[model samples]
Target: MRTVAEVARMIDHSLLRPELTTGDIETGCALAARYRVASVCVRPADVPLAATALAGTGVLVGTVVGFPHGGNATAVKEAETRLAIEQGATEIDMVLNIGRLRSGQLDDVEADIRAVVTAAASAPVKVILENAYLTDEQKIAGCRAAERAGTRFVKTSTGFADGGATMADLRLMRATVSDTVEVKAAGGVRSLDTLLAMADLGVTRFGATVTDRILDDLDHRLRDRDGWTAA
Candidate 1:
């Protein structure tokens, strides 16, 4: 039985839609604050607004660097990271160059991630694998590249992909990376049961647009006390 607060703590409380208005970002930040979520993941352009909205609260302000796709140039990603840091983003979730990773250009992939990590300075960088596109071998290679690049976390997907995080991918990532680095399971995480299952698999963070729904589910279950118990 995952509690509302427990589920909140694991969520990134995502608001990455390009069509999301400024008011939507504000609302998302407010929800994150009210729930005490781990972070609010918004688009790079909205980082400053989210940061301002989340001020005085301990919740982190996270933004994507390479965004939904990792096809951008390395210099672009670096500049994006630097700009995001300047805009008060505390965490950067960067998309790795899937093309490069799949081409077996491991050094290029590592360099791309390293550039962002360097630009981010003291802020943590999470390299998104966009797992739905990769083979198991490619996934392992991506994790290894991110690990070598000093990424703080290796994330599962962008949610734009056809699929999202899976238990198989989660376990593979956990086994591949250093225990010191974190695993953020993003994409399609919807219910309390799935969240708890991922947590059990060593995922510390989750990115989801339906975070409030998950919280609501937890609340409803706890209030009923008929089908579930406290976590």
Candidate 2:
């Protein structure tokens, strides 16, 4: 069984709901820090606030570019990536151009992702394929494009789509990308079992909104299994 700390580090505590307030971001950041999660995936506008709250906590600040829809122009997404990093975001999750990908414009898709990756420089970039809208073939192509474009991760969803990550999708993504490019499963990853199942299939990162619940469950289970007490 994975330890609570190990599970916590895999999560990118999601705070990207469109209606979230500044106070919500602060609260979310505190939760992420307490849990020592990998990062806080916040909205673009909230990057600075999240950065301030998570400073010295060792939790990275991540923001979305192009967001739920990957329709933004390449230039716009590139600008968004630069500005977010400038404002203290240490990681970026950018939505890929789903329309172009579906239209079989693979080259365009590669260029679009490369633009953001270039702007991100040293910071890692996770390309959100939003798998809910893609076919398996398209998913494979997106994974390949992301890898070729030099992205650090190829993500499954943005959690706002009609569907979320599925086992079939995760398997396909894992098979499509080399180990150099990691896979992130987002959306509907709200339980320990679900996360573990995905991890079994080679998923390395998760985008989750229920960080507390997942980590708390793991902690309880570990304590019960080992007869250990919390310090």
- TM of each candidate vs. truth: 0.94, 0.98
Give per-residue CA lDDT, model 2, range 13-69, as digits (tens): 999998999999999999999999999999999998999999999999999999989
- Candidate 2 Cα deviation (angstroms), residue 133: 1.3
> What are the clashing pairs of model 2?
none
- Top lDDT model: 2
TM-score of 1: 0.94
- How much lDDT does candidate 2 score? 0.95
- Can you write out model 1's per-residue Cα lDDT over 200-226, one digit (the tens) per residue? 999999998887788887788787786
**Candidate 1: misplaced stretches above 4 Å?**
226-231
